[model samples]
Target: MEIFMKVFTKKLFAGAALSIAAMSSAPSFAGENPTSPIMGIPASSLEEFGGREGVRAWVESLFYYIMLDNRIAPIFREFGNPERQIFLNTQLETMVLGGPNEYQGASMSAAHADLGITMTQFNAVVEAAYNACERNVIKYHTCNQLINALAPFTADIVTR
Candidate 1:
């Protein structure tokens, strides 16, 4: 399984890197454009991230990085194929990015209540995710958009 994750991570990196390169060649339509929605994230932004494919790769890469980190891996060590849950994560991200809201999971607080996670651990996970975003070619501004959207859940996610 570890070997499989390694393989998967390699493939995800390769693909995401390519996507990023492709997108970077053109200016992002998400920033300061007429189509930018007044109340929420713009769909063009999500499309820039490669829509479902980009989000899936980001979430999968997030899990891959999490598992690789010794400080954070213990939190997820019990789970099998965290990759399977990437769909749900993708849905939640899509929703955040002004797409459909099909994420039907527990609230972040309710979800992490039993884990006793700390701020340090949470930050580590976020940092690891940012690392993946860097490798995936997700821009800094776009990544911050996601962080801002999910910030409200910090209190719930960090129980300790």
Candidate 2:
């Protein structure tokens, strides 16, 4: 476990540095609330994700991917009741679609502060989410939109 964590930590910082360099030209997300809904998404966007039920299904798939990923699966083992987490994620995703905010969860930073989450894990989770959206047959554009809305939360999620 110690060896694995050491290797993981090394990769984590390296990936974080690379990501910072790559996103240097990206527009500032300053002043954006990580938990706030993204405004201006097309009304039909929620339909593309097949509404709340479909979003829940996608979140389930996302968890499956997370569990299958060795690089970050251990982090999630610290939590319990995957179903509850999926439900919360579904609500969060629904909220991100400019829908009703039913997400009864802590803020991203507070929720993850003690986890020592890293950019490598964050990116891995993002890729898993994208794959989940694809598997659910959500349109390509809508998947990108979902990811874009969630991307800015990296600042709140990654605790080093």
Task: Give the candidate number with the greatest TM-score.
Answer: 2
Model 1: how far residue 96 lies from native, Å: 0.6
Which 10-residue window in model 1 sums to the lowest lDDT? 31-40
Tens-digit lDDT track for model 1 on 68-147? 99888987886434754677788667656655545556666666889888777877777777877887899988876665
RMSD of 1: 12.9
Q: Go through the candidates in order and give the clash count of each.
A: 0, 0
- The digit string of per-residue lDDT tens for model 2 on 70-111 reads 988888887546777887788778777655655666767677
Model 2 CA deviation exceeding 4 Å by range: 1-37
> In model 2, which residue pairs have backbone atoms overlapping below 3 Å?
none
Candidate 2 C-alpha error for residue 70, in Å: 0.5
Residue 2 C-alpha lDDT in model 2: 40
lDDT, candidate 1, equals 0.63
